[model samples]
Target: MQNILFRLGFLACFCSSAFSGVTYPPITIDLQNKPPGHQITEFRTLTILIDTRIDVININAGVGFFLIQVHSYMGNITLSDDSDAQISGTNIGLIWKGNSENVAHFYLFRDHLALLDNITMLIAVSTYSKYDPVPGGCNLSFETEIAPYQKISESDDFITVISQPPSQFGNFCNRSNIVTRMYYLYLSEHDNSTEQYFANIQKMISVDDIVKYGTLVLEGLTANRFKQMYSRYAGTGRVFAAVSTRLGRSAAYVPAVSYGCDVAAWDADCSGPGKDIFSFISGLAFALLWLFLWRKFGIPVVAVQLAFLLNGLLVASILFYSQLGDIYIFANDATFWTCFVCLLIVTQKPFGCLTSLFYIIALSLVGSYAVIFAVNYYVGGNLPYILLNTYRRITVANFGSAVIAPPYQTMDICQTGLWVLIFCIGVYVQTRSSMGRPPFPPRRADRARARVDENTPLIEPNQEMPPAYFEAVYS
Candidate 1:
């Protein structure tokens, strides 16, 4: 115990040096007119000294999770703190938030604006346009709060996002007497209202942390930056939050009830004492990403990375194997979150030499999906319907079921499916550009040179080549 305390002291000292204080710089987001919406209102401060990068400990009051959103940057990030984690070797479902083998916790995800670097990635997703275009440049909207989901977390029902501290020393969910500092997210009008319902569980966070030291990335991303993030963690989903806005006047923060993974609704009317509608779409999005990675990265690396990316889950599976049969969908998001981060940092350049086919297959799916999803967001209520509607989930959940009420007056599932098929063509086109290309090959000469560095036997051309050549000629 003394040694453990000593280690804790050492860690705290190290963190104090590394991320102790905060002086986060404000990033700028350039939107065409009307940057501030009605949703950017009210303020409830959180802690500043916690970290939500790798380990996700628990989902309790004010300690396990927190949401950091910035409209100016087009980012919707969720930081989880689980001291305990676990993973498995399965391909269909791997890492999860808790100990359940079948479930995974949903970590936070963000989608940055497309124009940040002005360089379009050659991804092939079917949900978005093949050549989906946005503004020429991108900027982080520091003043805006685009996600409404971040708001509904202050309080509510079956889906409780723990706000106060936990009770037990190790029990992060029970303590409520303490207060700290970190990042805080406000709400906005032109944002994904559904996200407001998704839980932004945290322990203790404050605005001072970001306000004090978070550096503003002003130069914009270069190809090198993308390469670095990609090579390390190349993945299938959009990884940045493009904007944020908080509106206090309209929506009141109310906790909603939940039955299993499904959020409790008043009467399936899609309204009443519930949260934002953005969550369903966001959930669908990350799911699409998971599918894309499987198709692209293949199974080997995916398994290895998932094991590390979701260590908490691996721990849980080992300890909770007996209770595996019963777990919530919320417990399954951990693997999804791992896949989420993997999507951000994994890139194509690394595998370009190892295998081009894999890269082509992976990027083709992701690129197509991204293009189509973006197109759906832009269409507003004009084009909608499932099995084809680009933003079908959003429209269906928000308005009604597509089976009953289609978005447009005259578009059946078949007609919408045609457009979806058309969008898929664009995905194929972009994928053709991104796929089926040959990866880099290791040359014999290069290998020989590298071997020389390792004190390996040299196969000199002058000595070995002549004999081999003579043997070949004679033979």
Candidate 2:
């Protein structure tokens, strides 16, 4: 009887070892290059491999889980952080199944992080067993250490790295606040790369800090300039208030409530070029030049149009080249070239009603946009959506390296007043100047009359003989 019992015990041990090997393969998570703590800033794919026996679906708030609220903004569904709130992605279905494997993968649908700014996602790993959550048959048995394995292919859409929650976070299946690790990722707007090092999460910003520095507003602060100054503070987990207003009006600042990158990281001052002073001067110069000399500088006006269109094409080409391997829908080079050829044909012809009409419309728009762009630096303003998008894309494409500006949002009475004033003035001046002008350049008779006025002799040197002279000789 004793010998038989010993053989049964050995057989049981051998079976247990074989089952463990089959269930949990080697999965090592190299946390060396990643940001300090649990943050993952610059990864395309973050896969969390949890044991199949862990019960993640029925997590309870009493077990350190926080309530999440959903809201709608402008007809789009959104998540809100209410008082005593926390957020998660998988709960709301943001993380979909990338493969049949039991791994958690988060795929960010929005390309622009600003759209999802100020949002934090919590990932909870419960210790409850899937088979029995009633405090019985709890299988807290898994490998403690995992070895490194092969990396996912770069050619694949998602570069995958398997990871598991740190072992230090002890069992929280039945208790509250056993251990919870907060992580953050500060990503660049353009390439989703790490902007800077992650800082300790400052859950609260002092009232004094908000008043003394956060609410301080700068004069002539442009969206671009504001971002340029504040982006350095990104990932530092600082809080501040941002104010956009007209004519330095005292807009109430909303205090920062959460910790995220660039929530409102505005500086009191910037050393770069002053926004209003330079843009106002340059924009005013262009508007005034166009307004006063629209008729005199017709060819130059056409040239400017050419330059503008060509610049747009250049930007498009650069964007296409930069995103060569990525998939995106943008205007092709052939289409842009075709449009360029068409514009050249239209603008390069001799002055006519069509050309004159184009001159008035194009110059008026240019003047209007320039004035608005400059004035918005001092007083926040709104521009037409299409024009604004064009301006933003061009500006960012050119100067994204130096600074990244947020999209414009403010719209007030001052912006409308200035835009109307400048646009009307441009149209009025161009119209009054162009009145009574011939649709086409002067005909031969008109040229002859002008030449006679200039005291040219009737029988001139080597000129084509007039019909009158030929008729006399033939008769």
Candidate 3:
């Protein structure tokens, strides 16, 4: 009877050991501020003190190797005998206690688990802030080498892990949703190719899986925060398209969202209207200059014609290139064409130097006032002012919607005033020079010389007999 009791007691003890599971304490290590090239030798090890059997030991170093073990909870089956085993590349070794009843300790030695491809290892040990709370009772480190692990979804009590990779690990412990933010960690692995990285992203976006994941957030990785972020992810048009479609208009990390429009569109809107005004002002100024040159220096009609023809060719070339290449060159062509047309009209009619000068001054004054009126009209919320209307029609007829009215802020009123002053001064200088010059040359001496008649016969030096005949010839 005593022997029977001893056997029953031993069986009860064995059952208790089998049912109990090992619980590890919460650990957080912060390696974010660690200096580059610094090596870490010691880690806060997880030790098993009880005489409990370690059914399975799982270690995921992220990229080098993947080991999976499956065992039925109802049966005592061994999935893998990792005891006394060492993993290559990582140089990871497991130490078991004497008699092989329990695991003694687990540790990372030298640079064994220091780095991995596509996996960024960060230690946030015992660090707390208003934003991030401590993850409780979890000793294992997290890795995102697999595409599915790239996103973490949040709920009230737990967070779901999803990725493009086949393996599916259910919910992770998040007792109170302590980790409210998502961090995109980038690991620099020389052997890792960007092709696979982009492929994973493409797969995730195709199924619309990223949208189901909670809000995606990224911390600044460099000094140029926006530029870096843009270059890293948003630079890809496919990624941008996915982000825009999934998040609607509320998504973060999109460079276009920060501004009202994309870079090219914003530039066009800001410079469009201003370009129109500038072209008009340029035309007016050129007309004034043409008048001054003709009235003051007397530029010949042929010279004026040649200048216009050359200018027209140049403007045409600019337009052609703008159509074939960049749209910005349209501004230059518009300005040139406007000026060319103004000059052409003035030169078309035959006018004397004085008449042309006065006409140019009058035209410039009227053009300046017209500009002020057009600016005021546009500024006052009027659609299609005279100048803008004419410019828009021309641009649309030629370049489609490649050019439009620029924003009001781009107009330079002071510049217009300066050009007008220059025109007025030019006119004044020409007037003064013209007034200073004599209308015709003096002819007093020429009139006296004309009185001697060449037709009269010359008298011989020896003969002086024909005085009355010489007087008659002189008269």
Candidate 4:
């Protein structure tokens, strides 16, 4: 009996060893570069081979089990298997079946470590069977270390980075916080390649152990290039703010927000509060020139009409290039229809120029308000919707670096000023041409009577002509 028991025990041990699956070694993921931490700018993806399990036994039993559990303080996490199957939830249970053996592959996606100093990820795996439970079930576990650099400050245009001093080191040895501020400037002539752009960024932070700031001016970059750079480095914990200049107003600052990149406190259309004084001046000059040509050389009506059409087309083209085509088209149509109806009403009347000028001014005012209302409604009551949409579309379309919104306020002010100036010119012409006479020319009969009276000379008081002579003279 003792010999038989011994042989049975030996057989059981041999069967257990034969049925067991291959066990994978613990996975050690080192994210440390020169920084000694998993310092990531945007996001990271990791894949690990968990284990190789024999499915023949489970396939016959019609029961199998695979499980993975991840614990981390990272921003967000996603897990998947080698078969492109998404494992849902933090504690995941993976199902497996079939006659062949299979390897369990796990993938992980980690979010940005915006403000954290360090993050740890722990992964645990276990597999089992519902029936014919195998003695000594296999369980494996591993841990991944992630050290995220702390963010100092951030804006739409740039982000600042600084190393956190050790908690135990007290304030005495904690060298001045390595504060590095990066500024982004969009200039008219700066066009930097991707490598050059990144090199420039790195140069700003190259100085050792000192508080420093650097400016990166991107000039004339295509929209795609600009957006690429903006997205790549926007969240890297290095940029501070991107600043833009206007003709009359103070610099507009764009800060990065969690929702997306945007200009803070500024209209999406870049239509700030102040008038575009330069545009206004230019419009006034053009109107004065037009008035001079009209008064001095008597410009033809057809020529005037053509000029108006050309001006409209030019303005529309400008708006289209500036991504404000919709607004411009709306305003132009409204102005045109309004002026057309008003001109028709006064077509037969004299002083057409003066009447047309009045119509232009009134239409301009009405059109301005109409544009504002339409834009507001389209933007869902947000005044800056144009500017915001402009940025978003450009970025998404990969034209952000190349395309930019013109100063909408300036365009509006200049357009209105041009109409007002034309009106003023009309007033001046009327005043100068009809200063000492009636506004309308005298009738032919009146002119003839005046001439006869002048020729008679002093006949009113002393000399009285005969009735027949007077009748002949008047006739």
User: Which candidate leads in lDDT?
Assistant: 4
Candidate 1, 1-475: lDDT as tens digits: 5334434543564466468465322122111221111111112211232111222222222221122221211122222112221111100001111133311122111222321322111100001111111110111221111111111111121111211111212222221232221122222211222233121211001122223322122221121111111000001001111111112111111111112121223223222222346966886897789767665544545643443333323223222222221122212335424543454345433443544444444444344444444454533222211223222222322111111111122212334465557556655675576444323323345445445465555665555344554444333
Which digits, one per residue and each the tens of the lDDT, describe model 4 over residues 163-243? Answer: 222111111222223221224322111122233333333322221211234343333332121122332121112222322
lDDT by candidate, in order shown: 0.26, 0.30, 0.30, 0.33
lDDT of 2 by residue, 1-475 (tens): 5334433543454466467674323222222322211221221221222111111222222222111111111111211111111121211211111123323221122112344343332222212111211111111331212110111111101111121221111222441211211111222211211222111111111222234433232322122222212222112222233321222221111112122222233232211112446865896898688655545444454555654554343333333323221221223334434544554455434334466665565567556766675665554333332233334334433221221222222343456576678878888987888776643343344456546555677676877656774444433
Give TM per candidate.
Answer: 0.19, 0.31, 0.21, 0.23
Worst 10 residues of 2 by lDDT: 147-156
**TM-score leaderboard ranking:** 2, 4, 3, 1
Off by over 4 Å in 3: 1-299, 304-354, 358-398, 408-411, 436-475
Minimal lDDT window, size 10, model 4: 139-148
- Badly placed stretches (over 4 Å) of model 2 are 1-61, 66-353, 380-408, 411-413, 439-475
- Candidate 1 wrong stretches, greater than 4 Å: 1-355, 380-423, 426-475
Q: Is candidate 3 or candidate 4 better by lDDT?
A: 4
Better of 1 and 4 by lDDT: 4
Each model's Cα RMSD:
27.0, 20.6, 24.6, 22.8
- Give the alpha carbon lDDT tens digit for every residue of 217-306 in model 3: 333222221112211111111122112111121111101111111223433432222345787788799879866765554534544454
TM-score for candidate 4, please give it. 0.23
